[model samples]
Target: MDTPILRNNFKSEEYQINMGPQHPATHGVLRLLLTIDGEIIKKVEPDLGYIHRSIEKMCERDSYQQIVHLTDRMDYLSSHINNEAVCLTVENALQLEVPERVKVIRTIIAELTRIASHTLWWGVMGMDVGALTTYFYGFRDRELINDIFEETCGARLTMNYNIPGGLMFDIHPNFVNRTKEFIAHFKTKLPEYDLLLSGNIIFQKRMQGIGILSKEDAISYGASGPVGRASGYSCDVRIHHPYSNYDNVKFNEILKTEGDTLARYQVRILEMWESLSIIEQLIDNIPEGDFFAKTNVVIKLPAGEYYQKVETARGELGVYINSTGTKNPYRMKFRSPGFSNLSLLNHIAVGGKIGDLVATMATLDLVIPDIDR
Candidate 1:
């Protein structure tokens, strides 16, 4: 066959397009400046700070107890875990040992937060890839967890349950039973998630070998949670640090050798099961004692720097506090997982297609507020 050439000369140059700041696929107010050659992406530069609220700076002015609420806005999905990280940091600095009951409660809530977060991610990830039904299913499971949080902590998304010493209050009476029921209900539904999305032939092909991020690059970029674990990086804070009651619980850290989008997706799916198992271990034998440890009205940390890390739904959330013997911190910084994970976006997305870039971003689960903070 003879090929007919175009009469007009077309200058071949990569065209730049903006993906967000308002696009829904972005999942937040994140703007991605993408340079594309047709459908293939050549570069991805994330323009953040759209939702920046000066959270770190706000912590400097707020009291240690008040500072906990500011973290709620950072990774709102993992707000409970975010609050715990700050509480743990202050507790560690003051050398205050939280009661056994508080530790167990914190652990349970943290796992619930993880599961809630993953469910939402799974739903949105599917929708981002053109699978719409998965969104409803993901939210269906997530709402149950939200109900549990609402009853227990009185807030769904930004539950400021954790305090400097322990929890704000004891767990609700329905907390244990509701969690068990949700777990049992979700177990059957969880398999449906795999059947609907994970097992789809088209999805597998779209994700399996695309946006490949190697283990070394994952470590270098400081990718954590499912993102790092998908690349076979053993960066699980629970397994390594064992904060709160994580040391007592037995659950496998889900790891996948393949560093593709499919591997990242699979890691989070498997992690939901592991999170359920973790909750099951601690749900029954919650120690009977004070839910919060005794602390003074005004908590003043000694002049020193203190750091504490906890595994949120996204990854390792490290809270660093520099106190100058005052109720308010002299300086504060959060090592947010989303920000670190997002740093590797351009690296993995350079040679992939626009659709592949979407899949990769879905798996990365880059929460914008966390990044901007």
Candidate 2:
């Protein structure tokens, strides 16, 4: 037989389009193959691995001290938190008790990392949805946080500040004062964020009631962070599995039952306020003690498995290590929240407009390197 031409039972008006491996809206080297009919989406298939660095495989060859830096590359937006996760896991394996000062400082830095990540997301989200002014406003606030990070960690984005036992170094002398000033300034500016984008009638019309992801679907997808919380799923790792000084802090987990794009937006906005509150509570009272706990230069965990989880800007990041009593891990795996959250994209995007898909993905706050890693 030369060929067989099969006739379709139904002729669809739908067409396939590639959203990116480069488009800014997909947010960092994500390629989405979208099937659409007259502006309404029918299916979305994400093509990843463009930026794969094989971080897990890299961890196997690097020493325990050297591996900490690789986590920074996965979620650069939550770099500090990523660093802390590996440190926490290693410390737990070794049964090392980090000092109170270190815990408090780690918590503060993590919150600051959250705010900075959110700030950038807000800007990019606004631009994705056609609001240019919000981008400027978002970055303006984020720069302050970057300055603070630079002062303490000596790098703005991929700061590998947390080591196995504790911090790489003590907080700078001006770190406290600068952080306090940022909080004071941002409190006034945050309301403007609402007025600029959240209050806009166009934005409200575009986002509200769009891309609805129900609570059950969120849980099934393993969505975490603001995305899960927005859908009324209480999957906050900080709340369920308290690490560092998270248990000592008084802050609400921002939740919204609507499970729409607008609900996701509100969750992050509220979370920013909670992060601010967490920072204010600890900024002044950071205990006086050694920042870095004593650890041997050569670290080799006993032959066993170890895991530690922490709440990042996007969601829970769990660092898992299998040690064969070697300086390097036998196997290392990172449970990045972005992968789980991205899985639900096609589920929620179908039946909605492309604009709605963009809005929903924005709320998910995907950092693509996390997915490929």
Candidate 3:
């Protein structure tokens, strides 16, 4: 008898796994349906709406001033910036010019908000990549910025400080001095961030060349802020379209060409330095004038469309308003950067490991509520 033919038919198959709706690495109530073959990711599909609040629809029901507060809940990390975006949109619609003091103060506070958001991102991002110490270091520095916000706006995280015409109130008596102190203190601590995490060999290995998004892809995907800048796309709203005295200041829009995980990481680090520079330029120069521009008790826009964009910590936030000459907007929409940035995850994450996916996602610096809203 012929020797029995021996045959092996075992074959590997792709499997599906859920990364979150609660996973810590996801950073929020985001569910990622991942298709993997062993350790390699075949595909990723983000399942959103877990944190959706229909904020755009709510805008139709609320007055212009009330809508500003609702925006604070969307990108809470960039609450002040979000508030300013809507305020700028409404002001543009009414053809209103706020006081010079309001313009400078808004710019300074906006930069502080950017730094605070970046600090929190740095800590959590480091923690996501196994650097727990960064979390503590980041929060410690961010608290100082929050203290300044509390003194000026009476709120820290969800500061509904910006109204339609201008700021709800003026800066605190100690706002300038406290901000100067933060800049001095953070300058010393920021170097430590590099020494601890940025310079780590393992981190470099993990990040460099990973999640390589090309400049063309970045622009095609509507990536903005650091994400676009890292890919060599000069999409900084501050520079491209100056608002709130941004035209008066001089600062470099941090840019990188690598478009990898490391490039994204470095862009944010450099941006913090630029944020410090912006604040220093305007902090002492806050003009002597009113903090707000006076408008009617109920703001009604001309029957037309108006749009405004501002750079938030994650990226560019665009506010679009459709008015029918009413107190509330006939229609309101937000082009949130997180939503656009999140769209490119699958494009870059294919062929990488789950761990690589986490690192790449961390660099995107997604705020789920911002996306869902």
- Looking at model 1, residue 243 earns an lDDT score of 93
Better of 1 and 2 by TM-score: 1
Q: Mark the 10 consecutive residues where model 1 has the least summed lDDT.
A: 1-10
Give per-residue CA lDDT, model 1, range 113-215, as digits (tens). Answer: 9999999999999999999999999999999999999999999999999999999988999999999999999999999999999999988988889889999
**Which order, best to worst by lDDT?**
3, 1, 2
Q: Per-residue lDDT for 180-249 in model 2, tens only? A: 9999999999999999999989898889888899999999999999999999999899889999999999
**Candidate structures ordered by TM-score, highest first:** 3, 1, 2
Winning candidate number (lDDT) = 3
TM-scores of the candidates are 0.97, 0.96, 0.98
**Consecutive 10-residue window with the lowest summed lDDT within model 3:** 1-10
**Residue 162 in candidate 1 has what lDDT?**
92
Model 1, C-alpha of 260: deviation from truth (Å): 0.3
Runs with alpha carbons beyond 4 Å of true place in candidate 1: 1-8
Error of 2 at 251 (Å): 0.6
Kindly state the number of residue pairs that clash in model 3.
Answer: 0
User: What are the RMSD figures for all models against the true structure?
Assistant: 2.0, 3.8, 1.9
The TM-score between candidate 2 and the true structure equals 0.96
